[model samples]
Target: MDAGSMKAESRCPLQEQFLQRKNSKENLDRFIPNRSAMDFDYAHYMVTEGRKDKENNQAMSVCSPSKEAYRKQLAEVFNMNRTRILAFKNKPPTPVELIPEMHSSSASASSSVQQAKLNKPRRHIPQSSERTLDAPDLVDDYYLNLLDWGSSNVLAIALGSTVYLWDASDGTTSELVTVDDENGPVTSVNWAPDGRHIAIGLNNCQVQLWDSTANRQLRTLRGGHRSRVGSLAWNNHILTTGGMDGLIINNDVRVRDHIVETYRGHHQEVCGLKWSASGQQLASGGNDNLLHIWDRSMASSNSVTQWLHRLEEHTSAVKAIAWCPFQSNLLATGGGGGDRCIKFWNTHTGACLNSVDTGSQVCALLWNKNERELLSSHGFTQNQLTLWKYPSMVKMAELSGHTSRVLFMAQSPDGCTVASAAADETLRFWNVFGAPQVISKSAPKPNREPFAQLNRIR
Candidate 1:
């Protein structure tokens, strides 16, 4: 017969069975009688066979399938087809204990997979955009004062009696000193550059130096003053603190124990304090509206107790002062008065160079180490930041953001960013290449009655 005639005449039910089987395991001999099983991806078929091949460690590859195999097994299994046996249908699943290591592909049909999504841990965020904010933030722990970047190892006196030491390298904090009920909210804290020790100023005219490396409070000088501790500053080896008692005390940290020296000068509460960049002198400001520069080198005998120079132009209490790290003779002082303004003066000559005016009371002053620009914050007023050129005191730009009050400001060591703290306790950062922007606002009192009421009703 011709090929066309043969094609029309040939017909077999085998082709129908081959077309329907999911695994297509109808035995190739029933279709292409001469084909070998090697034509298939045997590794794939063996894995999908849903059968165990125990004899051949590797699954069937057109080879042996001899685990308890042969005519006897065939005769015994002949009575029951796959559907009648039913053991494979309701087989107990792979134990939950063994599922962790299994990485089943998504194409797999078995919904019985018990794999845990541990490698891709899910974050606890209700909103898709909610991020798991880390505590050891890149900049959150960087503490700063008028003197320097309080950005390294730091300590803070909080809740009156709680002395908290924080490693600024990362936000790892611990309550190191708890001074009973007599303690008031800590007004000042300082960490020596070496990070070996920390000094905390408490409300009760006391300066306590604690060895952070030793993890113990080393000593406390009670004879320094009889008033509430208000401000403290320290460098690598010295501690200088001024308090409501109007006394300035310098503690030598070089000694194993704290050695305290009292400088009698400011007649009113000393509200601001800073050490000279070279550590040769100490400057303290008082409610007397005076900035007194003390010759710290005069720690010797009967030297008359008085300021080397007194700056009395400021009519109100000076709140902050920044000593230039590059030049000890140049300094800037800020105060709160009827009209908000800051006074920049020469420490050596007591000459007022410029008086900078702000829309509100100035809370903090930050000087750029590399440049001569000064950044200041106005207490809770719009457009509170005044960035000005030094000496000339010309306004460079005004930064606006804090809706409540800008209480503190610090320029990063590199001057790439500036951090401003507000009465809102919200630390906002600004990029100066273009202009400063307000990112967020956090109230200092997070759990206050207003917030409490909102949460309770919610």
Candidate 2:
């Protein structure tokens, strides 16, 4: 090769190396402090030594190619490290601190969803009545279950000493049987499940079975109670009667010696008696402010331990007792003047599930078979009937009409109608338990005025 060409190529490599070293020194000074000062000292040494070597040897290079190459490599590495440090210092912020915030947001969202489910709106139900009839001379006793509507659409009511049968379909009333005044007045009345036989409980402590269709007394079962018989309930051929003597008797109507089983739990008058729809459980409430739950298996045993659960939460008389048609384990009972509370119990576990203050004396409680609703009849201040939505216990409607307190209530076989007997000497049929109806724009509403008025007997 020619000398000029070789010299130019070697000078080019040295110039490029020097340029790279100069740029790296500038970057180091801008990015790092103490390291930049060291790089400046090394650069000064290279420049001064190169000038001296050039003067001493004209044909040779100012510095050894190997040392120059090494310096260049060090400069390249420093530039790369400087670039990395600058990138790290200028990088964007991370979201590491937001992890807890994300969790809290999710937790709040789940709580909101659960609350929305609990507060969901319920269906709006209308309150109205279908018909009303006068229950003349109807006893006003709170402890007596004087009214019962049979499955055959016949209503049997005990007014004083007379037992009357009124055919709901034909509106014809007939006297079933009249008890002797010596038997004290008929305190309670209940019909058999088959709607063929009716049980009459007397103030004389006697329970009698009668064939209502034939208008004949079948037989009188004695040794029921020491005082007045106040309540009666029937499960098939077995009739249960509660009395003022605080005694409960179960009579099997199919046999002659009808007194099959006896239960003694209350210290005061046994005023309420009800059998579950399945006839597996019997719930009785008494004036002693106590509630007793009895299982059918207890009927076979003559032992005093037949009492399943003796609940004493009520401070006053517990004359209101009912078995839930939907839940067999559930039983509801209400207290009188002093307590004024309705408590629901799980009979299987003997746990009180819920309780509600009625604001007045709760005289009677009835469950609607068609809907998840409960009807509670009240006495004292308002003397009103309240329809409540079950489980939630929201008051759907308050019915007012009876001038006196409604002490007794009954449900019809269809499950859409309810008959409430009040001290006003009137029997009112309410459609409050019926399913809500939808009225179209073209159809006109019926006259609701009759429902509010008293329909006295002709």
Candidate 3:
């Protein structure tokens, strides 16, 4: 079978070996320049000469033609005139009015009038308090919110086991209610929007709604929290209460089943609660060094409601919460003794916009309803009230009279006065914020010259 076939097989191996070596040599030769074919020295000389020519051209460009002429030359050389004509690198300014007419006299007059309004004199604030009253037995606990001013111009404050109300209009003081030994001390008190109904939080985990006009209890709400209710805020018909059990409950006062929604997040007592002016959001601060934002639209009675934001930026307990009167999204919260800082937050985005170190404990915060200013009550070494300009945070004035820590502060209905109750047991009212501006609608009639009336006689 054969010598011929065996010889053919032997020849096949030699042919394949030759092809393999040839392919390898071809690949290796691809990267190597052709030394014999290409003029290496000439190529190098051309590159060097071209580089020198470019440098010389760049040097001569010091006295070159204008940019427009150069662009025209480029367009001509490349036949790009059509493309250049269609492109607009800089557009002309837009006309304010369609028809060309001069408005100089009227425009200048209106602008001058606006400038005069802008230059109005600044209001004056008194350095000393205008009045002072005795707040005997006012609770000194930092975690308890025991003072609030109602829209009715009535201020309610809790003292030990009894709650008292003072009418700011007539300067009358009256007792609101007193809890028994079991539910001894009142933890918090807030007035509803109607100003006639008040919500009283008790140490025995009870919330009472009372009618100030009739001076009678409306009802008692239970099954909301397991510990003492320390903070209370009202939104329309709904009453929000935060308790020592780290729970926030929304009670709808109109329905018999008052416990409507519950917010569960904080691990410690919630001491601060404030509803925004729009009544769409609620901000709560607790002893766990946490701040939570709850949205009313997301709340449900069937399940535990989720918080819109859980801000853990505070290093200590947060008790002071105030929503800006001018801006709905801006919120201000103050940290307790350990933190000694006031932080501004954008509630919609949950971003901390600014923070200022107060150097002392911030116990309460109140915003002027008529002005863009803020008032803060501090404790410990200073025990003074600070009036600050918002956004700038400049210390406008520092009023000091309390001998002990200023634990509570409330603003008057007109936002002209601030009542501060300190651990010193004295309630001092300051005329810090000036009276609201009164706009005059009446304008003086222009007087006619004597000769101007002679035209009618003629």
Task: Score each candidate by Cα lDDT.
Answer: 0.57, 0.77, 0.82
- The runs of at least 3 residues in candidate 1 whose Cα sits more than 4 Å from the true structure, single-residue gaps closed, are 1-174, 254-260, 297-304, 410-417, 429-458
Q: Which regions of candidate 3 deviate over 4 angstroms?
A: 1-118, 439-458
Q: After superposition, which runs of candidate 2 have C-alpha atoms over 4 Å from their true positions?
A: 1-128, 435-458
Candidate 1 or 2, higher lDDT? 2
Which pairs clash (backbone N, Cα, C closer than 3 Å) in model 2? none
What is residue 424's positional error in candidate 2, in angstroms? 0.8
**Model 3's lDDT to the true fold?**
0.82
Lowest lDDT block of 10, candidate 1: 128-137
The candidate scoring highest on TM-score is: 3
lDDT of 1 by residue, 1-458 (tens): 79756743563111111223234355555433223322234444445552553434344533655643563386467532232211213333344443343456742423244343333332221111111111111111112231123334242323235554434346455657676666654556655554455667766777776665567766676666687777777744567777777877766654544445677777788878878777777778777877788876666535445668877887777767788766778888877645467877777777888886665766677776656677776764473677777778887777765555665554543454565555433345565422233438752332221111221110
Report how far off residue 270 is in candidate 1 (Å): 0.3
How do the residues 384-443 of candidate 3 rate in per-residue lDDT, one tens digit apiece? 999899889999999987889888888887788898888877778899988855658774
Best-to-worst order by TM-score is 3, 2, 1
Pick the winner on lDDT between candidates 1 and 3: 3
For model 1, what is the alpha-carbon lDDT of residue 317?
73
Q: After superposition, how far is residue 180 of candidate 1 from its true place, in Å?
A: 2.9
lDDT of model 1, residue 418: 63
